[model samples]
Target: MPGAHGGSQLPLFSLTIMESVLDAIHARYAPVDARVAEILENIRRDCRALERESRNQGNERQVEEFIDRLRAEFGERVVIERQRLSAWAVRTTRWNYLFTVRGDSTDRIVLVAHYDTWRGPGADDNTTGEEIVKQYLLADLRAARRPALTHTYFLAGSEECGLVGLSSQLLLALGLQAANLALTQQNWLWAVVAAALAPLAGYRFGVSGSREYVKTLSTEQLRRIRGVVSVDSVGEGRLYIPRGTLGADFLHALIPFGDYDSINDLLEEAAHLHGIKYNNYLAGGTTDHVSFLEVNNGLWVRGREAARRVAARLARRPYTPPLRVPATALVAMLPGKASPLVFGGKIHTPRDTPDRVYPGPLRETLLILDYFFHRLDGGARVGEPRNLDEFHYARLYRTAAGHLLALKDAVEPNRRNVNGVYRATATVEGKRGIATVRDLVGWGVETRLRDQVAEICAQLGLTWERERIDELEVIGDDARLHFARHLTPFQRLAKASHRAIAAVQSVVRNWIFLTFFALAWVLAQVFGWALDVAFSLSTPFALWVAEHTVLTLIAVVAVEIAILLYMMARRIPTWIDNAYRHENRADNLGSLRRVRDQTLR
Candidate 1:
């Protein structure tokens, strides 16, 4: 009822295209084409089955039943793969069920949802999610023309048990697949989709599953995931968008958490039309995206003692700081109500039955996802996503752009702005170096920039920081850059030593002449003592003694001056050598930083 009247007011051209696609999906076809009734019926049947399934008994009969139902419903289109779990799953196994519908291209949009329940008949917990996947699969199959991207429906098991099904079963397989494809196809992009439980008054977003799934992937595997959509608890009191750490490079959308899909759609349209935009958003909560950041960015904090021990081993420094995951890789979709309550009052309880679930919210979620997929498949344009009227997109874009440009100035000397990001490159005496800098929060336009910046820094031998450098308003935008400085501890030490050496050299070089004068003065006094010891003078012979003392003093002073000059001369070369060594280290560091910056830019 909420989204029904809230039509997506897209641009006229896109709206026309969207309507055309929607019409086609609703059109009747031979051998029973896709219909809204089918979706509603499937939802009801799944909810009934879920209510009856005995998942808590641990016999795993429900898993088999669900698998059988899928096979019977889709025939050969259903493919089940057994996934062995780690110790984390507590010996529970996972079965990844996939239903694929080929399209005009090999690029896939994997829509996934879990089937495990906590304690009771989990209807709104996930029955809605299962039904949605079924609807999409059927619609894809019945379509006369193939869509732009391939559609894969993955119903994962063991999700209720610490995300073992999603992490080990689905993400691992996808990563392996992407790795294999990398040898031949470098541009392969895939998206994983999932929905969190809904129906609680305040609870309408659950993204932990999707977040953890992406975290388990290696970098190569992560590169293949271009997008991720999480459909958390929906059909609640107020529709809003999700906001937090989402693991994907592009096209991250979440439905009904706070209704982030609408925001995602608007950003995409704007990005596609205009160039990229940049800004900062909170990496506030946990979701499947957090896992992606973990795998890619190594974002975890060790215990203080453990970190101390590690730092001691590495550099005698013992502060194991919490590692901050770069926000660049998280193209998050934060859409849903602002309320934090994701599960309705009955979730995981005995009362979480079919009666608790409502068709109104379910239908609204179904339409949103339906229109989204069709849009991805080049569908008829409808209206824009909900809640765009409140925010100022143009101002945000302008501020972000200005902030991006200002990063070059802020990082100064070795860094320069390039392609809407900052790059540091330089070369000294044939040795090259490089690094890149981008927005730390990675809101838009520069989603992948920060991660890429990390990669270049690693390649160019620059020290990388795990957190943002600083947070200050830049050009009226909360522009933050990934904190990276080209100096390591060794380099910093070398720089200090170089300064000390230079100071010592200046003093020694000036003191060389002063040393001769001081030695002559000392020799004059020594000659006077010699004169007193060699000649005992009476009252009449005092003048003679004085004359002899003067002559002896001059001779001794000349000899002492010569000797001191020789000694100081011998030591000057060694002092010069030490100075040169320290200077070389300092110069090399500066050169390396410059070279790195130059190469990257």
Candidate 2:
């Protein structure tokens, strides 16, 4: 058959031959078998003890021992390397074991699994993933002939707490500075603050590890990459594939990143072709495959720009764009269960022991991956890239609508108190009611909307400024008038209430200064009264004239100056707001066009 690479004929394998090979491998390493069970138990015991003691050193030593064993068994066929990562005041060491089966081509297929545990035995969370990698390597070694592709087995560390090990390696490979992945006290504080004030501030904290990981790959390497399959939590239940980093629609709506559409399609195709019963859906939670998807959809750059803009606004500084890296999509996954928001419920707890993992799913996962790898080795491409602008714009609009609906529900509870006003302001035809905080939020959901619109416009080869949208007549005066004119009496009451409160606050602030002037006038009167009584007794006309005329004029001038200063101080905030708005209004065409060109290509 025709192949994707240089029109070269692709290698095809019979189903019977593939199944026979996978069956032989599965029989020996099935989770219930004595040999495999023993290995898994040992891993669980070591990881559980080390995690309890908080000893990453022990974990490193354990991983090193595993690598040493592999080296001894495979001899020259397996190449091993150790990578030491330092980030966030912590140091970690991870290993990469490459199993070379010299092929006609130089393309590489990467299989990844993290060996570290969060807590408990972690038999299902990741011990299953590690064992799968080892079993696959063994099968590769025992094969009588060379395979069609080279395989790189990346056994990572520190994945439970953060994707530090994987992210650091990717960063260093692409010549970028590795970020601090440690969750510090300050990070936790900000997380709390962000959660508490999320409604009003509309800010999200931290960066995606997957996004950073993808950004650290060069263009050539990305092109050469056949696929990156992450094996995680496959010890129990059926084989499952998640759509992207965020498995659920709500989570994706809130913070959209990563795009695994192409990879997911490939995996499903493989399953169907092999007659493997597998579960595929928009599952919840994340795994290492996310790193690839984040770059595939171009959401990582969007996220980075959003964060940079928020920081620049807060710090009152100009935002300078960071370094750029080329991107692609070649990530897939192997996991257990088919839950919407979780993989294995026992994970991260003591219940996640080896006994909870079923042998059937483990065997099925291995089969699926074997089929996927072989298909990729045959020079199969993951199809054309998705239109990221269309994808993101649809999600943006949906999320905005969701937020408005939620706001409406919150206000509905208090409707009875304002029912009369609501009726009074109802439209003549009664099709629409009044404007609440929801209307305000919907109209002002500008940050992501503006960014997405700018991106879409740039992709169309049009020069667009953010403020230009607001200038359009359809959305300008007409929309505002329409919203105001049809407001239910309740909405008008709410709006009037807001204005009244603001006006009261303004008067109260001015009155504070006015009180000082009043106090000064009273003091002057008292002093003048005392001076008059004393001067009358002593017959001093000059002192009495100075107190009545010059002193009084000086006090009046001082009060007037104080009033002027207060008025100017009130305008200071407005000046700052206007300046910020103006800065953002600058045409974003250049940067957006470059991004569009780079990502779409």
Candidate 3:
């Protein structure tokens, strides 16, 4: 390598000294390709062996054996914790292994890999991740100098089954039950009910393991964490640096997680510097990194407080304030050769064997990670706290408001025609007459249009501030007008009727008094006879109803089921239309843009 600094070549003697230093640095953590291959093979073999043992005994035996192996390899530095998780009436125990490497500074870099496999040998799915972490640890152990940042390797179990291990641990550590965390103090009764149902809710939500270990950490220790990198499925194919979990925009809006952009930027820089080919992806499914990001951000506390305020207002109860936590948390991941949008390859299949994974890509991935860790440990900036509310506002403004504007423009000619007709039909003969009524109706329609626009914006998570409504008025008219343009004249009239109906429904849906009135009407028409029958014990009809109790119960159940089906039929079409629109918007917005082959000189 040339010894140059800022375009100035060094003296021959200085060049020689620089070469020696560079050679020493390279030697410190250089991984032999053959050795890496051998380690991966051994891991696959061990997994297969334990899997056989599992068949003889139970699946827990395989998990235990894997834990024992970690203890043997990492020795005293390894700490293991057991977690109990229940899902769908089946209870299982999973373990999380932590391998701590002390360094000069308390600031730490956490690396995670899930060792649990799905249906198969799981060689490419996660054996590669385990090998990568193990190699990094071995390299650190062998280096002459202590690392600048402490490194913690978190080996998570049971990631395949809906993040059970990850979510359970995080919830436990945060002193939260899955359901009650979303309830407020004003909702004490509801909170109690939620708590009682937490276990079943937790299981359905796939809550289960690493957070238990996180809970054990002191506040100082937690704050010292610099970044978390989850290594997964890197045995073959192209390397990918995942930014976040895909299709989690809704969950993220409610409970903000720390941004991973900084970590992603660093990964790209490191890969380019090391001449590694890679892609930036939003992972289709989540990994262990999600747990770390969610725990560190602490925005769930703020979200719960907002929920509490709303609950208090609704119930006319005293509000309880929420504690604030800083949202500067960073998390990133390196997934093995896989599709970002769909599950591709032989992952979770019996065909995901050792031979399927290539050593060349594995070694390359390790090198890229090595460079990434070095840069990160050198005090590179890792995270930027995001304003999630602002992000949602911008997105809504762009997608919903932009569409509304486009639709408004598309119907501009029609609006002009209608205005022209109103102006032309005005007669000054006797009295205002037809023109006066038309003008009044037109004014009402215009007012309703603006209000509807504001209401739609509010429903989409934007504040109904006057300035924002004014901005929308400037940009476009009501969204219904835009959508109505695509319909035939009769269809457009029908749409107008539908809008009127919807407006009335919205009033009844939103106002507590109106909702109660509607409920009372439904009870009077549908359930009053049943209640009357129960009350009139002395009547012949009541005696007949008591005689055929099972038949009456079945009839009531059938009616309820029929009502549910009708409601679903009315909603499903609208849901599908919205889904298509969202997909189209995503495609137009370039959410899946890729940066490829941009290596630095």
TM-score of 1: 0.40
- Candidate 2 to truth, TM: 0.43
Model 1, runs deviating above 4 Å? 1-44, 50-53, 56-79, 90-93, 161-221, 246-295, 300-344, 378-601
Scored by CA lDDT, what does every candidate get? Answer: 0.40, 0.43, 0.46
Give the alpha carbon lDDT tens digit for every residue of 1-601 in model 1: 3233221222222311244444454342311213334544655565565455455333245556756776777676544544433343332224444566766766556666655556565555555566666666666666677668767665544445333333433444455445545544654342211111111112212333444344454555444433444443332322222222422211121210121333354334332221122112322233332333343132122235456677688896555443332222112112222212333345555555555455444444454455456565666443321111111111011121222211211121111111122322211122211122233321222122343344444454554432222112112122212222357798778778786886675454334334445555576678677657656655445666566877755766677756654444334533532443454344334321111111111
Which tens-of-lDDT digit does each residue in 1-601 have in candidate 3?
A: 2111101111212211233432333455653556665767766675677465442133356557756776676676544556443233121235566667888897888887766666567777777787677667767766677689888777665556534433653554344433344454555665665565445323322213444455567767767887777787766655556533321222342222434555665565444333445433333344666665555344456467778889999999999653211111111222222322223446666667777666655655655566567666783321211111101111112232222211111011111100000111212222111111111111111112334344455556543322122111111111111011123577546545555554554333223223333544474467757658565755776777789989977887677655643333333322322331332232222211111112222
RMSD (Cα, Å) for all candidates, in order, is: 28.2, 22.7, 18.5
* Count of backbone clashes, every candidate in sequence: 72, 6, 10
Please identify model 3 stretches exceeding 4 Å from their true place. 1-26, 55-93, 162-207, 246-258, 296-299, 302-344, 379-601
Question: Which is better, 1 or 2, measured by TM-score?
Answer: 2
lDDT of 3: 0.46
Off by over 4 Å in 2: 1-55, 89-102, 162-216, 247-253, 273-276, 296-344, 379-601
lDDT of 3 at 44: 65
Model 3 earns a TM-score of 0.46
* Candidate 2 overall lDDT versus native: 0.43
Per-residue error (Å), model 3, residue 408: 39
